[model samples]
Target: MRLPLGLAAYRALSWRAAQPAQEPSAPRPEGALLWLHATSAERLAALADLGQRLCAQRQGVNLLLTVNAAVAPTEPAALHTASGRVGPVLALTSDHPGLIRDFLNHWRPDICLWTGGDLMPNLICMAAEQGTEMILADVNAASLPRRRGGWLSDVTGPCLMRFDAILTDTAETATHLRRLGLPGRRIAAMGRLSTGASPPPCPDTALNAATQLLAARPLWLAALLDHDEIAPVLAAHRDALRFQHRLLLVAVPADADDTANLIATARDNGLRSADWHGGDPIGEETQILICDDSGDLGLWYRMAPLTFIGGSLRPTARGNTPYEATALGSALLYGPHVADHAAAYARLAEAGAARCVRDTASLAAAVIQLSAPDHAAAMALAGWETVTESAALTDHLIEMIQDRLDQREAAAHARA
Candidate 1:
């Protein structure tokens, strides 16, 4: 495929190849390989989530994540799932012809999901020449890449023509793409893609056993607890206990090794505590269940109707995302320090599915109020709805990728 004049000029002037990646990846494995490129940091998480969903559903799908960012992250590493290393996460700094050639020749992905549309003419044109099934996702006027050669006759339009499909973030973006001469059939408005993950698995046996043992006690979990949060959390639990004596607080330390210290802290605060690993029954008198790891945090989310995300309460920025808890039907209580996951928490708060607790007093109050079975159930419903808001788009992507893989497999067999 001959490059357009703009791309030709870009190729001519593009002498500086991409830097040698710091990490060495294993040779590409056999089977369908999906390459997802994020044009910036904000778009990376959604692609990463898509990778995780694919891995969970289809056992052997290979994923490679690349980023074309203004700056490389301080550290770049492999994108790992529970099974193991999915693939290398590369930061593609330059799009010189040589760099693009080496990348396409070496990786030779079965399909490409080019996200946020910082269109790399060299990369896209070369990959299309190789007959790679390319899809540009979440394209908007705001996200389109503008380069030096953009002033010349048409890099973006001709370059985008290489894609098999273009998914825009809004109908307005679809119109924008049409203005650039892309056929309507190739473009669709799929609102902002989600970083939706499959809910953490909870074995039926474990869930049933925990349910029977607890016997429907009012339960809440303080997940990913930091060292500094120990006193305040236990105190909150103690205070909430006055109103709801049957309340159970499941405290999981951020570090498994801190289990002993948390237990000691509970004892010092005159609260009854039992280690989950200690083989002690969670009787009515057991005020706190000290869990060592958040590994089984899924089970706790199922057992408890409400959860307080940890890092938020500590003297730091936001806690971990509450999506996991929401996915598993748990309402959320969090602190004001939620910079990391501000958007997610903000959504939940607006929906009344989550509360932002300012201190020990507020945390205790929220636990006591939200623990009502009806109230918690309502919030959990809202949370679950919020998490699944982007389900239709997610399902479509999964199905599309699956169909792409199936086509590759069938084509290979036909050739054989």
Candidate 2:
């Protein structure tokens, strides 16, 4: 029952590849290994949430999670423990691949879960060789061009095929993988792991304040706005102001300091603006509210009936998550370059739940059109429908993981 020599070699190479300059001398524990590479703070939060959920559902399961040092510098950070029995989440940095290797050697986990990008095929091969179940959750296939050339073409195909279970966000991705030679049985359409049913809960007081401030005002949230797109966004904001005098624009700047420039831009374009940096109460006459803080998009999305997702306007930035807004009952308005989440956005737009604006002018017009009471309500309804349709897929994924664990335990009992 030993794994093939090639597979064993692959694991050894992978472990060595991940080794840091200075090796740790301490002994590691044996448990479940979860390798996560979250590019955004939002994704990092999601991983933490998933870890908490898993630990709560399954007791006696030791979990070791790896994050990039840049993302989470501090090791051994406390994760929100599920039922308090699954042990504290031990966060390790991948800055020293050697440290990662040392930790893996010490903690021989039963299952290995890889999240985010940065696929290490050798790691997958190693996990398989060790008789550990390998699951790649929230996995995304590279865009077509990226797959065609260079080192990826050689390594990606074989590396991807080695996984015991590959869960992707969309059917389009599954088809793409099959085209790349991954067996259909091994690849399942798990929808997007980040697309959950609810937004992170916000304080009731803040929610009430936002609601009261938005009463009878045509509100539009332009989230994650980059610096280069500011001019066009301001132009669109002015256009919206012409029709709806009581227009409210909530801008979430891409950079924290960019908030000052955004407010200045709005004023330069003859639009009245205010800042919410100090947690001040929004005055009735405030035309725009600049939210400079982080991790409050969940609350803002819920406060608005219509939202224009930023980072799409200019060619520089691709896009941010529209699912969060849709899940919070807001109609989506996006620009081009949304290839990252193209499938989900396409589905929502086709269903009349979302609109993709080609430019600043189009964005302005769409906002005005969508702001009508009846039109806005219909879009919100369609949005909720599109988001809830994936509920079954979520449940299926949870069930699949649980069933696998149960089967593993049952087999162990039989052997004993």
Winning model by lDDT:
1
lDDT of 1 by residue, 1-416 (tens): 67678777777777654544434445887778899887644456667777878889998788888877452553232122211434457778667777677778888899999887677888888899988999988787776755565422477778889989888888988987787678889999987665554678888998888888886677899999888888898999999999999898999988888888898989998899988878877788999999896888989988889999988876665468788998889999988876666667887888778988988999999898987889999999998887776677667787888998988899999999
Report the lDDT tens digits of candidate 2 across residue range 97-173. 34544555666766666665556555555556667677776666652224335323554555666678888878888
What local distance difference test score does each model get? 0.80, 0.67
Q: How does residue 378 of candidate 1 score in lDDT? A: 97
- Model 2 alpha-carbon drift over 4 Å, by segment: 1-29, 32-56, 59-198, 279-284, 403-407, 410-416
Error of 2 at 279 (Å): 6.0
lDDT over C-alpha atoms for residue 344 of model 2: 60
